[model samples]
Target: MWYLRRFLLRQPRSHALCPTSPSSSHAPSSSLPSSPLQCRTLSSTGGAGFYNFPPSAHYDLIVIGSGPAAQKCAIDSVKRGRRVAMIDKNSQMGGVCVHTGTIPSKTFREAVLHLTGYRHQGFYGKSTFTSSRRSSMNEILQRVQKVEDVEAEVTRHQMRRNGVHLVTGTARFLENGANDAHVKLAVLLTDPEQERKGIYKHREASLPKTLLTAEKVMIACGTRPVRQEETVFDGKRVFDSDQLLWGGIDRVPRSFIVVGAGVIGIEYASMINVLPGTNVTIIDPRPNLLGFADREVVDALMYSMRHYGARFVLGEKVGYPALASTSMEQGRRASCHMWGDFEAIPEHSMAAEQGGEVKSVLQQGGFLGRDTERLFPYGIYTIPEISMIGKTEEQLTAEKVPYEVGIANYKELAKGQMLGGMDGFLKLIFSTEDFRILGVHAIGEGATEIVHIGQVVMAAGGSVHYFVDAVFNFPTLAEAYNVAAHNGLKNMGINV
Candidate 1:
């Protein structure tokens, strides 16, 4: 059905409604058509044809890809009474974030932790919990697959409930009209009947086509795993992150060589290291893993992973150019740092190396500096989770910022003993001059969740004194904050 030259016809006005007239600037306001703009049905030979259809649909906004960004945009537009349509190449409604990326990865992590009894390894002997048994790939992936299906269905329901038209196909941009009045898109439509019948099909030259013109177009195509140029990914011998999640391997390998020590690589390494008899070696050209995080927290995480049979090969590039994990802009500006230019924050390259500073600038714009925009927490989900907010000791020393440190080991706390993570601890850094909290770092169970307390405190310019004065729930991991605050105050020669 590629022939699309049926010319103009009238339909209900709501089929193509916009707040303002989009056809022409010279057309009278009253002359704007109150019905669907003329649309063309497709015939077998209409690939090159433009808006040559009978009256059909036109959207105020057309979003490409059904990832979180695209989904939010479409839903928000529909909420504002704007006609919206979303086109995704995949047959599934939600994009990679739902099927292969964040959701699936996190769910897979949970499944692994649960099935392998990783969390309980602290209480029971590691040998008793892990070395005793091995889980099959299908057993672990069953939960991941179920979670993905549910998430995808929920995303589909949300789109349908919100009245956002869902189109299954690949879309390409067409040349815009004069003055860019309307953006035209040519979409290669897939057969819904086949999808309904549960037949996995691929797009073919004979597939139907349609032309859609929108007042606005948004590109939300998600990301893919970076592959080394020299590495050929066969999804068996060597697999990228996407391939790993897409069920490429027959079983968890006895050994894994992850070529990048960034979050993804480290995460997969940690997940695999938890499996019985699995050895994971993480190789990165950069000398550090998660360089954007606090060095102490990262070190603690590395130590924990190492204790669990994971190996690291830093300062050696496998294939790709050694660049900072943060931004390309930061990389270009960081040539001064001979350590392979791994600067996370370009402006304060020496003061802070956390990427959250860049995120703060995007969310809160101004003449932003190191102090105002450098307070956000990041979590690395290794075997023993690590998370931190604000500046590191290295950053403070480089900036000549006077600070005092407070430390609290989880083993000293009843909750920590009960939870069985003895290596976990929370560290607090505060200004020596005013006792204002500068940073919060944690490595242990629930480290990510625990860091938020300090994030809220630092956001309000609260100091270590706040923790000392406030009472925390007894036997809770959160009490570590009070202990750390007191320790910091003690370090500063304050008796209280």
Candidate 2:
């Protein structure tokens, strides 16, 4: 631990790196301020390493991972006149957002809603529903690919135009001490045969190529779907969200059992149910869908989901092979866990008939909400999407902090009503003593986008009254801010 701390302290800091506090000061020698060109050309031959002269390339900043953060860092560095290198392992850049996560998922969701006549066509008939027309996976893939290609091209052109070098490679840290070492990135080259066959493959043809020696390294490697080793993804019945998005809708599972109830799970379940003849059973321990959402919004989501024929298994542990055990405590604890807390369930007990299948368990761990157990289907998207950048109610309770709660139903907002979405809402938790906003939770259409408003308020130590008095555009979803603030003031016995 001491060595690790020393190593971290010794590593070069970038100008773009935000300090934790405004008053915090760094030692002059702690940072290495060098031009990008100088950093790219800098070499250390005398250092102890397998490579004698530490590849001659240098960069003012080296961003590992081509995701949004990395791309932003590279772009910012270039704008600051620093030589930067943005690298990724994939054939194309833009990371998961452009590839599988945000852009593609949202796009697929839009397409699904459109094709299912969810957004419109209510005038045709009360039961007016289009036949489940599944879009071709190839078509969706091509559309995503085309958009990614265009984005990659634009990024590449912009970087080149601004003089930021883009490298394709895998990066690892060359440990010097705890924090005193530099990064080693090996650029992967394509094989001629694979290239000829029209398959994209990264073959280590020669010695690992080093494009840049960086004084600073930023790790922006976005996460991937984490599946259990014991339960192999069959690419059909059992799959991750990324595979679902890229693989196509033709293989839409009938009577599908989604192991998780987080954002991705709920979103997928919602999308699948929009398609005719597809039944989705979301098995999660949380009593409400989008548990991290505002309580009102979560209730609305649950209401919306019921209308879509989505099933939820709440407050119960789900295991494979249909077990008789109702709770996590009843299941036999096994050493070899496949996904989550895998307990053997009796085959006959499962709603879906399957033998020798393991049921994933969600042990209600005290994390976000009280009396809520954490269940199986722990996906990374669950963390960032549902509960990003805020203190949970559990945390606030643990700290014995005094807070005021403000609620706004987006249904009351003109924009939300205009969009035919009554589920959108925002929750603002603030300190009753000082009126400082403590946390913000939102859900529904544009929930993710609008949460930032509260985020800025809380981060800046602003008061709820600030939002109450602030003027918002008419017929906007953002009007929820003013409404929430007004509600909070009313709770405080203040007439606004």
lDDT of 2 at 352: 11
lDDT of 1 by residue, 1-496 (tens): 0000000111111111112232331222322233443344445466432234322346777877676656766776676667888877565776656765567767778888887887777778767766756777677778888998888889889988998877766666555546657666666565555555644344535555556667777665444543334444566555555566656566767766666565656766788778887777776667777766778778888888888888888897443233212110001111110111122322121223233223223322333445644464777666777778888998999999999999999998999888876688999999999889898999988888999999999999998989999988898999999999888888767899
Q: Give the candidate number with the greatest TM-score.
A: 1
TM-scores of the candidates in the order shown: 0.76, 0.64
- Report lDDT per candidate: 0.64, 0.51
> Best by lDDT, which number?
1
Model 2 spans > 4 angstroms off: 1-61, 79-82, 121-143, 170-185, 192-217, 248-251, 285-296, 315-395
Model 1 root mean square deviation, Cα atoms: 11.4
Model 1 per-residue lDDT at 41: 45
Q: How much does each candidate deviate from the true structure in C-alpha RMSD?
A: 11.4, 15.0
Steric collisions counted per model: 8, 16
Stretches off by above 4 angstroms in model 1 are 1-56, 191-204, 319-375
